[model samples]
Target: MVVEEREITVGGDARPARFTSYDVEDFPVPTGREEEWRFTPLKRLKGLLKGADADGKVQIDVDGLGDGVTVTSIERDHPLVGSVLSPVERISAIAFAGFTSGTLISVAKRAVVEQPVTVTLRGEGGTAYGHLVLDVGDEASATIVLDHSGSATYAQNVEIRVGANASLTLVTVQDWARDTVHVGYHAALVGRDARFRSFTVTLGGDLVRLAPTVRYAGSGGDAELHGLVFADAGQHLEHRTLIDHETPKCRSRVAYKVALQGEGAHTVWIGDVVVRKAAEGIDTYELNRNLVLSEGARADSVPNLELETGEVEGAGHASTTGRFDDQQLFYLQSRGIPAVEARRMVVRAFFAEVIAKVPVEHLRDRLTGQIEAELEGSGV
Candidate 1:
């Protein structure tokens, strides 16, 4: 059980091709090596380190950028784009010991982008890695959807930045093939008086791990995160969220729900909030709930909070993980509904709270359809 660990420098402007090649050897295990990835399956990580070449040219698609919503390629030469590139390439370099190209996108300052911009990451041929960087400028408003799906197994890293006075809605849907091994890193910096809302849906992948990190650097700002994870049969899903309040008068709230079923299906939630001394008058809280559907399934919810100031308005955290609510199930079945459908109805009702918070109508509807399909299999 060796968890491979690699020293990844903050990637500069260099793309994958320029670096001298080296084989991934004698690397330390990543399990226990990184606090953010403590609960992940490092044994299965060996697959990425087997050192295979990338499957070659990957294609990314942006769906329906209607009028008023512009799509512009982020120049690779841009200083900010190059510096803030996601760590996907570094991870892929460790697993495959090779270089890979990635993507970057940015919205103009003070621009109101009405239509939601959708980016799809599709893999082909073999194992691969992807990086996406998104920047919303000051006073701008936009909705972004990043979809990960395709024919091959791989990992992805996404970085997002919301400038001061800006508002951004981000939705991520992982609908990868059943055979894919997906790990995602989401990092964001929220500026003063800015608003950021993100929703993550996990409905695919053999093993999926998502880490979303946020830092609120401005006063009178808010950040919200919601996640829904449903796993069944030989699946492993793990989600970690970190919220940092470095400025006063900033607030953040996070809620995540997970449902698991079948043999060896495991899920873990790690929610952390840190309020610095400078972050006085802050309000922050987090909640994680997990539901188990079978005897063999397992789940864990861990919430951690650090407060450095007493001047805050309010602060707290809560976590719970359990089976379906027996009372709710019983009530449904008593209404003449079959037992399986009744159980699923309860589960769907529980998850609906988070789904309803999505601000984008199209994304909300699409996600509802997917969730319903998953519940249908549960016999609801």
Candidate 2:
């Protein structure tokens, strides 16, 4: 279906509606005038917006493939690709046009995976384009972990399609180098009675932007999006999401938490949810909370909800940004903990609720350690 494609005002500039275009010609090079590029540091993008190619500079390595999972490296577009979502930005279109090969993952029907599929993308240097397509068979359940590290200017697209009654859990960890710049588009098509969960943790990067979109194909679909960001000195992190509720009896919940510290730290979160007139009896809500741990950090959060009809069950949005809880820190300090330790305790407690949901034990431990390290470096 063609989108309404309205433009909303942001900082006096117009922001394009969700699901704009899939063609490269439809998206032009952004000059930082568009609403999407206004918050991002386009000057630090390293010419990625001009449609740069990889030129054999980046390396993508994958490990930990569970049983009943088949992987393929296809150089051309497959039937399953582009089914759920399309490229809505210029760099994402460039990544779609200049990919060396597309990774295709297929899970067998009714197969339960014992281990999570881990894919590590190491950026040696230079610019690169890439894509990934995951097809989960009916009644199948699986977990995938996509990890990024090292230095590079990269753009890519990810599409996940779940069959009816299937379940998919995707965890993306962006642990890039302090000089890396990466942007990617991720979208999922949830089927009837299916469940989709997306968890993202952003730790290191000079500038990183992630866009995730969701659309329900049938009734009784459910989607949950959770994100964690820890930005330090001289880092810029951005995340935007779109949830399209076109079918009845579908539900979506979004929760993104972030912490900023040190000089030149910045983060942005944009949440857009649209419920069509035909989508009756739907339940959806979005929440974004930012914690400023230091003096020089900045965080921008916006949640937009558009409802065509009021026949839906419930719909709402919330956004909050503030400093640390001094009372919580005082409570910890009064309990015999040192001042620094008390601060660390408060920071950890802020993200403990989200970290505890990691189904992978070792990965959860790693995330906890990373959070603790961030707290130590915060100097708060």
Candidate 3:
């Protein structure tokens, strides 16, 4: 395959160009100096960047199979495997080339699924490669939850397709073991007049890096992406997002929040949005916020917005990283609340906006409990 490169002007400044290819050999070994790999700890990747062979397996399970849903296995060379996603980095390309078969979940046309579908992937140990695809037919509606657990070094790719006039709500939870290292790429293509909403929750793993990108297949498409990250001691969690507005009259919104505590806890968030010349009257915005709770913890946030045409409806980006607000804590303590409980309240309020938007009630309650547990364990 041919390598494609393009230059983009973001915030009136020329950013580094990016390339995409399907072949692993097209990408050079990252030296931790490139713009894309600068914030990542390459030494702790566990050889995923080198396209190492899988020595273990990841067991897959699915539940809530309804009237319109179909789940099956397909070969790597299946027609729909690479129809919606193209590899933009070495690890994703390596995963695409290494996996022999993948799981496909499809929804029939004009069907409505009342029950939410859940897919669980459990790892045994060692290294593994995997792929998954979710296809929503025209005029259909469905909700899906992808739950990840167990311990392993895993690299996977997920492709999603939303047909014309369809709606899809996807939530991906990463609750891996402390010894696991995971790197994944998720891409989605939204058809004309389609709606796509995604929520990503990252809470575990030693080193986890995930990239999610979206592209519009036709005009009048809408996309919204939300993420939550909580890192404990010695944990590294990173999320990179790209919203490419290539069609006219489309809209996109992105918001992500991070909370870091304990020594050596680190988090990174990169938000990139591009509006091509042909994408006239487009509206887009991205925001990222980080709160550091203790010493020896760090957070990095970068937001970029690019516009090729001046006829946009609105385009903007914002990123903020700082410690907790003293005034808020003081206000809570003055109300006769204990200091420890006040701190917990402040943290919960910080993440409440995102948590409240989750479509599942049980999931929202579970995530709240998990956040409380993190605060108690870290003695925040």
Q: What is the TM-score of each candidate against the true structure?
A: 0.85, 0.93, 0.96
Off by over 4 Å in 3: 3-18
For model 1, residues 313-374, the per-residue Cα lDDT tens digits are 98998888888788888888889998987886778788888888877787778777877777
lDDT of 3 by residue, 1-380 (tens): 74456676444554444567889988889999999899999989999999777998778899999999999898887888988887888998999988877999998998899888999989789889989999999999999999898998999999999999999999999999998889989999998999999999999999999998999999999999999999998999999999999799999999999999989999999999988877899899999999999999999998988777788999999888888799988999999999899999989999999999999898899899999989989899
Candidate 3 overall lDDT versus native? 0.90
Provide the lDDT at 144 for model 2. Answer: 86
Model 1, which residues run further than 4 Å from truth? Answer: 1-27, 31-36, 49-52, 56-58, 66-77, 82-99
On lDDT, who's better, 1 or 3? 3
Off by over 4 Å in 2: 1-19
Minimum summed lDDT over a 10-residue window in model 3 is located at 9-18
Worst 10 residues of 2 by lDDT: 7-16
Query: Taking the tens digit of each residue's C-alpha lDDT, what string does model 2 give over 1-380?
Result: 23246654432333345555656677777778788888999999888887765764557666777788988987755776667656778787778778878888888889898789888888888888878888888899999888888888888899889878999999999999899898988989999889999898998889999998888889999999999999998899999988988789999999999999989999999999988766789999999999999999999998999886688888999999999788987888889999888877777888898888878888899999999888866677
How much lDDT does each candidate structure score? 0.73, 0.85, 0.90
Clashes of each: 6, 0, 0
lDDT of 1 at 57: 32
Clash-forming residue pairs, model 1: 3-29, 3-30, 4-29, 4-30, 5-28, 192-218
> Which candidate order results from sorting by TM-score in descending order?
3, 2, 1
The candidate that wins on lDDT is: 3
Q: State candidate 3's TM-score.
A: 0.96
